[model samples]
Target: MKSSESRLGQWPLLAEAARRDRLGQALLLVGDEKGCQSAATALARWRLCEGSGEEACNCRSCRRQLDAHPDMRHVRPETKTIRLASVQQAVASSQSAPLWSPMTVLWFDPVTAMTLEAETALLKSLEEPEATTQYLLTAERRDQVLPTVVSRCQIVHLQGSIRASRPFRPEYLADRGRDLQEDLTAAAEAVRGRYLQRPDPRLLELFDVLVEAHGGIDRNLNQELTRETVAMWWRQTVGPD
Candidate 1:
């Protein structure tokens, strides 16, 4: 584990689990996006490090891995979902020895983004793993994942990211569609939590757009159209509108 006084803090339990070879076949790390990604990256670097088994975070291998070396496979969504091809590629790579070392480290960030087919393909590999392959999977919401996959892994809940602020009053979202409510609630919580340094004029514009999306989704408008409208609005709201 890294020093407790370090900015990254210590993860003695995870370190011990890895040392004991009790990290299970698959490690499911659950947290908000930022926290999950950070933790996953740190763990991956630790595993790849040559200086210290517990992730000294100062070794040459650790530096390269954290900086995203070619040998360290990072599987993520190229589009909305993780295609079966991605899983196949990862599995194939896992079978091979490391490009730079003896161990292969694969980080499947946001593993839930994987499509059903991709996930099933991944299961086969997980069921029969190579002695040198290491897998780290992260997810924001586990309920969205397939139970079969969930059951195969050791769930490591990492409650590091800040939570979503309480949603807008249910009455405020009463007429909204489930999707719009989710979006508005996210936006409202972001703004209310003071995530932005200062109120952007575009934020007011986004609020207006969310109002419109809520109405459209509620009215059963065209799903594609509603999504596009809301996306454009969000882009403008978050961008230099």
Candidate 2:
């Protein structure tokens, strides 16, 4: 198998940025889903790959690195927010040199999860990154990140490309569904004990089906379902039991 360093696709702008060593303070990959993160990660990997040219696309290093490489670090939230612990690990990792390549790459995905504390901690490392350390950060909303963090990173807004793969399941679908239901219940109880605003039974039933499907999103379940579910949940909860 060729290395990841050797198999990077040619993106003129990114190539120029890397060729000029204008990695700048950092790189921000803004996207709403996994597809965006993957693209951003690929770009970061290609830039840091040890191939002879801009992106050889057939080197052993490139291949291995793209699939899973020690030199490439991906930081994400264990839960909803990027906790301080994860940020600390990333910081420490950034300080180290690549185990296989000349440079080390770090990609922070779904940066929206970074809590205030985590962002503060990350600022220090981003301000003075290691000589060979480079970062590729992805966020759904650029405004969600602190200005300080954004200022230190080169903003690369990715649009339209959808990541067509799934990562490992973190939580069971039914459990997530129950959690959502409970959240809805709590919200409903908060609005002056109103029960009339309870979500539609049909919507809840659909969610139950989805939970059973275990993250397998069906085409039949359109965006309207999501909208209706949330609306019903809010309406029911606000009205009373």
Question: Which one is best on lDDT?
Answer: 1
Find the 10 residues in a row with the least total lDDT in model 2: 161-170
Model 2 segments beyond 4 Å from truth? 1-11, 53-56, 65-67, 160-241
Clashes of 2: 28
- Would you list the clashing residue pairs of candidate 1? none
Q: Which portions of model 1 miss their true places by more than 4 Å?
A: 1-9, 53-58, 65-67, 160-241
**Candidate 1's C-alpha lDDT?**
0.62
> Against the true structure, whose TM-score is highest?
1
**Backbone collisions counted per model:** 0, 28
Worst 10 residues of 1 by lDDT: 2-11
The CA lDDT of each predicted structure is: 0.62, 0.55
117-212, model 1: which lDDT tens digit per residue? 888987888888887887888988767767777777766555522344545432333344554545554554454343257767666556556545
